[model samples]
Target chain A: MFRHNTLRYAVLVLLASAALFQAFTAEYFGLEILTEILILAMLVLALDIVAGFGGMVSLCHGALMGVGAYAYALLSTTAGIAPPVAMVGAVALTGAIAWAIGAICSRSHGIYFIMATLAFGQMAYSYVFEAPIFGGDDGLGGIARLDLSFVGIDLNDSRSFALFCLVVLGAIYGVSVLILRSGLGRSLTGVMHNEQRMRALGLTVWRVKADVFGLSGMIAGLAGVLAAQHIMYISPGLLSWTVSGEALVVVILGGLGTLVGPLVGAAAFVVLKHELSAVTTYWHLVVGVILIAVVMSRANGIFGWIEARWGDRIERRLSDTTRKPEAKEVLGDA
Target chain B: MLETRNLDKSFGAVHVTRNVSLKLERGERRIILGPNGAGKTTLFNQLVGELTPDSGSVHLAGEDVTALPVAKRARRGLSRSYQKNTLFDGLTVEENLGLATAVHTGNATQLWSDSLAKPEVREIVNEVAEQVNLMPYIHAKVSEISYGVRRQLEVGVALATRPLVLLMDEPTSGVGPEMSKGFHDLLNNLPRDLTMLIIEHDMDLAFDVADTITVLNYGEVVFDGLPEAARGSKLLKDIYLGNWEDA
Candidate 1:
């Protein structure tokens, strides 16, 4: 009888509780890992917005995140702006930049679109690597966290900062879910499914793609802000095409369109990388093997596989619970 | 009303559309009959702004939209269904209709609200579903549906846009005779004032639904007249290889 997505809500609750538990109980190193996973999860979530739903597989998301991180770092250190205001300005700037890129790249489709995004990503990476004001390859350090010390929350502490990142990630996940259920999400899905049909139906398909890309960029920017705070440094590596490629890998390894899957994917990816790299420097090869296995065994990814196994059962149970009383009432009436 | 004048398109010496001029008044049903490579689809493309004519103009509601893009032309009340089934196969039949209606009603960009929750979009989706006789399969995924149902959905999506001029390219291209008759009935039941330019191969459907007929051969309009006159035209008989009497 309840029309809400019970299973999705349940999964979100479970993930949130787990994140909170880790935030409260994790050690310093554990908190660092958790914060890294949360930030990367947010970035992958942003990637999914366009890649999974909008069918625009962008390779410039890492660069977009870099723009946010650089902007936040510069505004706080050089421009002398406050951390929170810099965060907002960085996100807006990244969104504007991504919107322009998306508008230009919208002219290309499929492989061409991917190449166009790669070109943009490489351009950003090269600029950041060569620019003297950015300290070139050395990157900029001494970036501050979103100072909430006046509110009695010391973000300098790992636990407090991790909790803050968890909160931001949760908010982003919630907003993403809302966007997916909204009209724009449906339009994006329609555009992905049949762009020609969308155009025939009077939709400016490129505009829709560009708008979603901009929204996705803002989310990636938020992730970038959190990431800079987590590391207290900004580097050109953040803008590298390899970063974009890795994010794309996480998106696929988790599952394409499933929002929560990307979080699971990011966590799995970070944990795997951390654990494997401890033993072997050739962790990329091992991760690649695992990715291949996941892609082969489950086309939907690990989260999708989990949902495929249990999602229907949970939905049916919820509906059954609601329908029983209605059935009884109908029987009594008859 | 949709009108095309002297629409000529060539692909490097091969003329796909040759001096094709046509006019459809308000509330008119014009059926285009042509064999393969006749450039009927090309003509429709030019009219809908998918392919621009080399030296011609397309007008919709007395405005020349020859320079406008596909979406802009569609916004000015020109909509088309593809010869092939071009549908959102990932979505349900109702979602397919809802998306078209959402875009048509200017609610496509609304990011905060549910599109299907809007009463206007739902109403139009339901209406178009009923119009296409797809109410029974409204909840079915387009990919899971049969080929014939997809054909109906292709038109349903176009109708949901609430177009002033609807161009349907082979709405019943592959259906059996029985289903084709049903599709014909569906077309006949549509609102009389909805102007339509249909490219059809079936003579039974062509003669049955057409108020006027235009025959295309080698990218040129060979004959254009009333259906009764088209039936008796010697040129049409020659083009059809005396298949006129079979209908």
Candidate 2:
């Protein structure tokens, strides 16, 4: 358990240093890719909490993010609200929408859940695509970054913005790690594993599901706000099913339940798509092939594979005593 | 502490549980016995709020709970183990017990706090695991444990919920004879404050543990009395072991 903690911290430190180095040296195109990766990683992290850990396997996450993006876009650009206020509005709107959706879909499981969320994604996509207030197919533009002059931060500079986004991503990851160790997290796992047994044990399964969904939606909304601020643009494409599908792919590619896996997945996905598209217009074909190869090689995703190779070696040695802290780690309590 | 009034449940033309009424006093060990498809498990389900009776009311500790959902009924001091092993197969035994205890203590909805770090919850979970003699396998995943150990864990899970009335559906169904004796020992050692309503196929086992017995045949309660009197019941003999005269 100590080994696992040390290793996790080590990896986090390394990632942070790398992020800092990239922010300092990267050109405009490189910084754009870096910022996009951080934003997408947050999105995938939200999905991982619901689909990977909670076993909801939601397909409407992109729509939830779009809810946030649209909220920010309209409030900041049209209503002339402060960017921070718009961000909060975006997160609030996404949370409410996600809770409503979860209330309707939480009772259904397996394929039915997938279909219901997929339908929701399609609904949001169509609504945004045709809604005149949202600029329809053309989308909203000229969105500015949050006024952080009080904090002495200028987000207009790409490097500063990328660093800020990275910090936000780290904060989200920290909160996620804390949640995965909480009582509610265990209850969510219980619901995912055996909902009936959870109910028998006096857990309100639907409420757990809805609460988890709302939390995930809030994070996704944060990602959306950051994405809008980073790009200064918004479109119906932000709400499209393809974005959800890509996030799912990242979750699967990184590792389902392991919290760090999605970050790796987001990085791999963004870099691969950017580089492959430069080589050929048929970038999706290459992406699909690479995904198939990675998934086939490492069934548990890259992080699970790493754990099996290295983490388990240290873990096996610690299992002899069944000490409290170590045992909790074995259960992935944190 | 539990009473059912004319509970009736049916699917299309087949009535699984019909006019089934029974009572269990606090601290008593009551067993319901029946032949195949005689609604023994179905009765247990209705009592625990797993199945809504077509027309009946359920009372737990003098509170009417027929309209409550399963979790609410559980919150009202009801807990149950399934006929099949419905464990969180991927999680460790400690985690399973922790989750049950967390829910029982109303700590299940805690999102920001680290539950495992809570000394009280951990102490309760460890106590339950120790009670069930599952301390050795606490770190083992449910799927990695032996069948008998899994059975113990199932009971441990129900016990961890701090139930006032526990519904056990065929607790000894899959265990071998030796393990069955261990189960008997475990039940014998349980806290006297806990009430148990059990469904068992083994007559000897049922009679051994039960303070009182109820017999069901074709979804109707044909007999309810002391275990000694139940053994002498001609109706029970005819329905369970076939013909009393032939025996």
Candidate 3:
């Protein structure tokens, strides 16, 4: 009775393509929203790794993404590097920053961790907002799209750029799934549960925290580069603590531990913000009310509610088959 | 093959662990018994690197590990269980054991390898689960299991590390008598290659499982001898059993 849902996979593929089809044909406004969703979804996925799974609720991931965007801008424009190389450089730089922050913050638990990350994020905001080399308050502009004319793909075309963003999102999703099912993911889960016990089990707690944070930062940096390419602009606003706060909200409002919730949360967030802002400038008031309602009624977020209703049964069936209960049966028989 | 020399730790004006020196030979089962505030747990903390001693050294298998961190000491074949449950609440029994084994084998950070898909890891996890009689609940979440089963998984987690010296702080503290018996049988059936250093409050369970016994009173060792000698000591009766032993 528990067969793999091939039809479900097909439906998912069809739905994904339908969204892409809409992006390709929709007006400039719709295409821009789709691009923004892809970029922000990547950020939320990055946040999910540390805050959702590792139980380290970071408030500086937005600043980390800013680091990536700024690095890309500076490296490509100033150092005369190619776009791809600049992006990689930005990710590496952000990874280093995240490592330093993680080493300090991972020492603290609960509220202390949150406060430490918030402090670091504010520090990033202050630097970017004041530093003249980064365009200070005015921010940077004229970020060019990747030159893929050699491959006959004109990235300046909106349709091609949208497709590019979609492919990147798909790749990130696949990678995230692999990571969540691996030993590293298990260790992070253990760390989240009990760091002391993980230490006793011969796993260094700080190192694990640092590595995960670095990985999260790298992924966030990837989003940063994409955002830069999409808007052709980078600003201190990108690095503000408010951006980090929003990402944290998205992760929480989506589902804290579910990998797919953040993606859904990103979509809901962008759509809500876009639609609500049109109605009134007090759009934030409505968002606040919705967040409160979600927290009070469904603490697990929208995806969590869905999981409770249907995802759990499907998950249980799949896991039951994947992990044979032979030993359990042997014990029962005994 | 474990030794602690002149381990001293103080908190401001209060001395928690005082100049404590202890030794355990290969394969010896030594239980440290004390009153509630005798600082037995503090002493264990020093041995496992959870709390560093202000002075003195911890030598495990002839290596000086006094300056080593908890995970490094564990990687060098020193492992322990906490006094509290400390099991990963969201993970399953098999997952808890598998995590221990994965870290022990230096595979905790293999991002691409599916741990559950690996047959050898699964086999070892099952084997450890069987040893602790936790096979039945291997697929159940830790939060959904009984406290007794959680206790077994705690030991199972430690054992999965394949430690040469196992340090347990009150392994059967909150478990019922029926469950304690099962814990005792599991401990008794542990391979002779494993040396155990246990901190236990249950005198009967401690005496039954331990080949040697050490008694601590107010941050100091009052007795270190065979189980028979410990049982016959008047000081032990005074501190732990009280005058009611005569009844």
- Which structure among the candidates has the greatest DockQ? 2
Tell me the tens digit of each residue's lDDT in model 3 across B31-103. Answer: 9998888899999899989899999999999999999999999999999988998888877788888889989
What fraction of the true Cα-Cα contacts (under 8 Å, chains A to B) does candidate 2 also have? 0.78
Tens-place lDDT per residue, model 1, B192-247, is 99999999999999999999999998799988999999887877877767453353
* lDDT of residue A166 for candidate 3: 87
- Report, for candidate 2, the interface RMSD: 5.2
Candidate 2 residue pairs in backbone clash: none
In lDDT terms, how accurate is model 2?
0.86
**Candidate scoring better on DockQ of 2 and 3:** 2
Share of native interface contacts recovered by each model? 0.76, 0.78, 0.74
Per-residue C-alpha lDDT of model 2 across residues A230-298, encoded as one tens digit per residue: 889999999999899999999988888877778888888899899988899999998788779878896
The model with the greatest TM-score is 1
Residue A52 lDDT, candidate 3, scale 0-100: 85
The model with the greater TM-score, 1 or 2, is 1
lDDT of 3 at A284: 87
Model 1 misplaced stretches (Cα beyond 4 Å): A1-7, A313-334, B242-247
lDDT of 2 by residue, B1-247 (tens): 9999999999889998888888889999999888888888888788877888899889999999999989999988999987888898988888889889998887888988766667888999999988888887788888778888888889899989899999998988888898898888788788998999988887778878999998887798878899999887777878867663453
User: Candidate 3 lDDT, tens digit per residue, A138-257?
Assistant: 999988778889999988887788888888888887877777778787888889888889998899888889888988888898899889889899999999888999998898888887
Q: lDDT at A144 for candidate 3?
A: 76
